[model samples]
Target: MQMLDGDVVLILGGGSGLGLGVARHFISEGASVAIFEVSQTKLDALKAELGPDVLLFKGDVTSVDDLTACRQAIVDRWGRLTSLVGSQGIFDGQVPLRDVPVERVSSLFDELFHVNVLGYLLACRVFLDLLEASDGSVVLTSSVAAYAADGGGLMYTASKGAVLSAVRQLAIEFAPRVRVNGVAPGAIADSQLQGPKALGLDGVKQSDIPKEAMQEGFKRLALMPTLPTPLDYAPVYAFLASRHNKVVTGQTVLLEQGSLNRHMLSSAGVSGGIGTPLG
Candidate 1:
């Protein structure tokens, strides 16, 4: 459809996982992308895979100076930005509030909020003018946790909640100039946010689950009964970013195959709550 042709997008955390998946999809659909991320190795990999068409910027979303530089670089390259996708976050070492030490709670919350919420705001702040120039859209990568209680600990949950609110508020504030929206992904495989032990188990262990258990668990949560990949979630972001979805601002699109609507997760009649989606 050439819906996004001639547009330029800035994707924070575009080095891997869902962000990388969306980046590839955007390039395929004929849009330029500026990837703002911290991982040099991932950036190098993306450069190898995508070549000169992709712009690579090494910046931490939590750093205002870095984010500002990224915005300026984008403007210098494309003159304006048509889309902004904030996909930066972490799932490391977040435990329940009750189990957390009082002294450590503040720092934990600070780190998560700094990266997930503040980082997004800073990026939007620096690039609002550029986005507005093109009447662009911003799509934040929120989680099912934002709407439900089953995802992360207090901090991560709170961070996601704030992310959800940010999308709505940005949409309202930016108005007709720039559309703001979000996508809440569910139960994606090969996610990067594993807990402190390298496997990073908030609840489910990716490597421990057998293939049969994996499929059944997905069936129990997703009404559509299909295993979805990071790539599966790309189309929604593309739609939200494209001119096709002109009126979709302030909405959080669900990409969980209907898992968010189910009341109970009964994999073999087990009474465990629905498993949280990773990545």
Candidate 2:
């Protein structure tokens, strides 16, 4: 049997990037898939392309009402949800704290934290009962930023650090019933990760950069030689969200290509950092 056969999984913010990749990978692994995406464009396209086989829901991850309603819909259709993978996040424009106008700091903090941190908490709360019943899993996305500097700006790093902590706390609180874990990835190829509206960078995306520049820059720092795509990171998310993950909870698996492991810095002194999105 397939590893995920019979599992009912939800990929929150699955419209694009790592979430989309996980949703598609889970399906191939034989699990039934449902995705919650805020983008209307993604919802329409996914529904048409993935067909009746994959359930698609439209909702913002930070909205309690949206998540609650989606929860009910999942129960109504599949009767149970075995896993939830939180894959929604926004970048902080990699702005230095001093460079950010003092006024924008509060708005920037709220914007990034609400989506990157609170969204995952709300999803876990909304779906706790179902997950407990099934002895399922909760996998949240963190970034290499949480551990090392230069992975993102101050706000983005703080938000991801909160997510990493939440994984540990939720694992303990949820107890033996539901497993909670996290994945901290390095620069993802083809990432659609965008910047915060508070900084007026919502229109900016990592994909807006030249792909060759992004890849080569990332390759220079990464020990793994090549940058990884969303699909390249999906299998780890899949295993964490599956029944096979019995012994792994409360810990975050760092798949950062050993980029940050270098003790020796270039003459540039970490100035050669890549600005691409880290999952």
Best candidate (score: TM-score):
2
* CA RMSD of all predictions: 6.8, 6.6
lDDT of 1 by residue, 1-279 (tens): 575788899999988877888888888888998899888988888888889878899989988899888878887887788889998777644466788667766767777788888989998998898888888889998888787776666777788889898888988999989999999987666665534322224454333335578678777677787766778898899999988886789999867677767755354576745588566
Give the per-residue Cα lDDT of candidate 2 at 218.
Answer: 70
What is the per-residue lDDT of model 2 for residues 1-279, given as tens digits with 9 covering 90 to 100?
888999999999899988898888999999999999899998998988799988899999999999999999999899999999999999987899999999989999999999999999999999999999999999999999999999899999999999999999999999999999999988888888899999999999877778899778777777785878899999999999999877999999999887876746463577646798577
User: For candidate 2, which ten residues in a row score worst on lDDT?
Assistant: 263-272
Query: What's the TM-score of every candidate structure?
Result: 0.87, 0.93
Clashes of each: 4, 0
Residue runs of model 2 more than 4 Å from their true location after superposition:
263-279
RMSD from true fold, candidate 1: 6.8
* TM-score of predicted structure 1: 0.87
